[model samples]
Target: MSSNAAKLIPVFAALALGTSAQTAVAADWYTGAEREIPRDDWIVAIDAAATVTSNSSAFGAVTATIAPVNTLLDSGPRVRLQGVAGTYTYPGTVTGQTVRGVQQEGSVLFGYEWIWQQAAVAGYVGFNVRNNELSILDPGNPVVGTGIGGKVAADIYLNPTPDQFYAVNASYSTQFNAYYVRARAGFAVFNGVFIGPEATLLGDDFFNSWRVGGHLTGFALGPMKFSVGAGYAYDRVRKGGYYTSIESRMAF
Candidate 1:
């Protein structure tokens, strides 16, 4: 991780904590009919997703959020934890041989969220640890060496009308100079189900990729929500390929 990136961690942490304190103070000021109704004392949410591309690259991630104050349905502070793993195949140094490399990452973040009737935004700052293993060094792989570094992330959701919604998720880490961003918009087709188009951009020091796809989102079964997406992907290293992904989330 770069020293400059590591330096930013303290600044972000201070800002996040300051904002949470202000929010708590403001909440206390409300009284009588102006006071917000409490929904739940706490909430825990888990999300898992996996993606596979035609170019012999695959990735999976899981994230969990613990909000002692129930941030999912209300504004509050939360602790976020995430784990990611990926494998990439590339040409080996030896002729007619291919090498598969593995990468893993874990992070913990402190964050606060603000919610409105139709929109919500959240920001997080934290530290991350990453590891990469390869039998042969491959320049085509994005994630390179193992390191501990700073990380930041943001999520936004907007519901403009009863039938339409949009969401964006982005994150950056000093480890291997990696970054990821995804945006999607959906239109309701059923009571609570939506279908939409989605796009993603991600890269690191050595590799970059973009994907354009369609997704089926907001499908609820019992207590979980599920989504599926498929699309075309283009990357500097892999050239071009197709990708498919599935994601599920549950909160309690």
Candidate 2:
């Protein structure tokens, strides 16, 4: 081949390579992490807990919640069923069948969650079923009252290992507002169980209560997560009482 022809061929090949490189770079560009929103199709979480709380007045109730799926959200229209029933020995050693429960329906909440990429900070506007039910300890003669509740929280990265999540939340009901803050970190405690303790601050019309406790959760079952928690709620009026909760959750 002629020298001129050979030189022209090399130039065309270089141009083709440059064009291919540009296309590849554009296709491969990515932000690294994807913000995944929960699916809207469906969700249901059931929690069963017992609270032994009572003042000079009466005993507390067993707390249970059957929260049906609304839209996919930290915010959305929802119907939550709350029930609490239990017995306690009064100062007089009195005990019997004590039960009280309530149901609540609320409008959709706004600002489900806030995610910051620059600082790796995450925040969420949390909405729970308003406390439409308040029961006075009287299994023989239970009284129900309607109330409301609220919550908001944020979490920030503290450790470089990305294994710890520190979170804070505020929750209140018409009865009274409860404030809670906690620093949570998890390690392989046993059998890969992630356990973290959180301090709870509770305030209300009946009395003031506080608790410090945690939950043990792990992916033990196939394609499912199992969690159970226990805590001690110290009431100024009700004295000292114990609380326990168990939950089974599945995600698709």
Candidate 3:
């Protein structure tokens, strides 16, 4: 096996071990508590993560989102608003130069969730507004545009044994010159704790990327929950790249 492929084995194993060992109280919000699923009339959440390529170039972003009503349950639909900011650093097409790019975006989404005997599904569609700064070499130029995006996610808590569950989540977005899709899956190893694989396909006309990796998710402390993942990436036509990401959510 190539050295890079071999490196991922240990990382995946370690993540699995960490996930399996995370035993929380069944009453915890994520472990089939009396609530079954975590929900709130209003929720405030933040997601932050970074991805790095084999060339040492990197991309990082932070997003803050809010839900104004109870929408994650079998009840009714909900509306959400979000803001994001991120930076990208990469080797310039020209030799001996590094290019840095910045982006800021805002979006509003509306979606609904449905709950069955032991499962729930949710989906949402939204409009996005964004500002993309050109390059570190040129500080005053930015391209601004509008776009559309949507997301779909589902969770199934095992019956007879609420400690185990499976989940799938996916999202897609498109603009005048760019579009991307991301998807992930998870299976519970312990009450409220899960491990799974994830993939991403994102980029623009000038650049694109594909990545796959395993993840650990649903580590909750009170009303807060966390997730983390890492994997190798194939950037445009190049290989040997890798990426990692983490996120946290809070419901109130």
Candidate 4:
């Protein structure tokens, strides 16, 4: 349990630490002929589907957050920090370009969250930025340094009830690279164990895709909050391919 909370620390830190108006951010390569592929040609992963409200005008992002209203009324503000990394690969074709590329991303999330004052659920807001690394897969080709991008998200949800969120508020990233908007729901099978599925709509460049995944989170572990999620995305362009990721968030 302690290890799980450690995984989510970075995500909580990027909270208010994110941007405004809008910020968007994305991933690896599947196919391409040019060792020098344009940013647009990059395959956007199918993870996020909706736009958010916590972003700034810098990167077409929205970080929307609704005040929390606790059903128990005892619910109060929650704070946290999180950090994470991921790797992805795909196929592409670049004219006059080369097919030598690799990508890596990581970020820190920090912010405050709690049950909405008007709703029974919960939500949070924060800032986040990711360092993207691009490289030449060819041993003989020169490896390009990693590129940089930014991201931010502020959102509110109906916490996790038997049914998905009765209501939700969120933001999305569009400019940086790619992001998504989604609706989430789940159920608790046992003590300190919750599992549910989420549906996501990917951002631009990346083919639009749908995702179904589950998360496991616990809030009773003292001041330490921990959660992890796994999901698969179905692509419109790749009938047999899917996008998958595991994420965790924690509060200290």
Best by TM-score: 1
- Give me the overall lDDT of model 1: 0.71
- Candidate 4 regions exceeding 4 Å error are 1-84, 94-101, 104-152, 159-171, 206-208, 215-231, 236-238, 242-245
Ranking by lDDT: 1, 3, 2, 4
Candidate 3 per-residue C-alpha lDDT over 66-98 given as tens digits, one digit per residue, 9 for 90 to 100:
435542322446554656666665565645356
Cα lDDT tens digits for candidate 4, 1-252: 233222222222222110011112333356533343112111111111121111110111222222133211223443323333433333333332334233333433333444232333334444444443433343332223444444455554442332222223344433344565665554555643445666666543433456566555433333233444455655543344333333322211
TM-score, ranked from best to worst: 1, 3, 2, 4
- In candidate 4 the C-alpha lDDT for residue 21 amounts to 13
Q: How far out, in Å, is residue 95 in model 3?
A: 7.3
TM-score of each: 0.80, 0.47, 0.64, 0.45
Q: What is the lDDT of residue 147 in candidate 2?
A: 46
Give Cα-based local distance difference scores for all models. 0.71, 0.37, 0.51, 0.35
Clashes of each: 0, 4, 0, 84
Query: What does candidate 1 score on TM?
Result: 0.80
Most lDDT-accurate candidate: 1
Name the better of 1 and 2 by lDDT.
1
Better of 3 and 4 by lDDT: 3
